[model samples]
Target: FKNAGFYRTVRKNNQPNNNFKIEVIQGGLFSDEEIKKHPGIRHETTQETGIKHLDGTISMARNEPGTASTEFFICIGNQPELDFGGKRNADGQGFAAFGKVIKGMDVVRKIQQLPDENQYLKEPVRIISMNIR
Candidate 1:
């Protein structure tokens, strides 16, 4: 997990109190090619974990419309919109969340406040630490 990329994200969740931190490990954030072969693997993994919405912590990845690679985000809020809205899979289903942040939330807030261009952060936030559970 030490080598994985870290991202600070803001969620467009329905709740005003929605916002938090998340960390992606298993080297998932560093390769789009790797994810192409196992589409929706993250979503499946989340269901098995039985944890949805770190409450405030959020996670990010490329939008479901295409292949998601080295970019990931943290939940700044509860993003129900991401869960539904006719946003289906190949068969038409909603996207699924994979993981959450267990610590380092202050880092997320700092990253989100960084300057951005066209909404994408001008500079990618750095990962302070990552650990496998």
Candidate 2:
């Protein structure tokens, strides 16, 4: 759905100046009623390789309590602050990570360093296409 714009950036409820450019690994299923029920579906120990708990690592986005969908991102750098209960998840929970970039490190960096004056891209990132394997 992200590729088709079904979902929008996970903007902070109150902080109107902060948002992340996360990647949606599998997007279409997000609108599916049954799938939304499983929030912990794509997460594992944050120590896994490629999907390690590093910055620039792409992962799944979820609601505060754990409502994951097909959306994910490549952490531009090490962001333990976004880890479970870190600054980003001050509520004592955090976003679920599902995958990482096997390629495209440059793209991730570019997106991360973008002029996020409002904490979100003035021109938001858009997915061109998606595939499943």
What is the per-residue lDDT of model 1 for residues 1-133, given as tens digits with 9 covering 90 to 100?
3345443333232224424222221123554555554555343323444445444334335555334444455555454434434222332333345566777666666666665543445666555566646
lDDT for 104 in candidate 1 is 68
Q: Candidate 2: which stretches are off by over 4 Å?
A: 1-51, 130-133
Q: Name the runs in model 1 displaced over 4 angstroms.
A: 1-50, 54-71, 84-92
Each candidate's number of clashing pairs is 16, 15
TM-score of 1: 0.54
Number of the predicted model whose TM-score against the real structure is largest: 2
53-111 per-residue lDDT for model 2 (tens digits): 47545566665444565545546556665566455654645556555566676765565
TM-scores across all candidates? 0.54, 0.56
* CA lDDT of every candidate: 0.44, 0.49
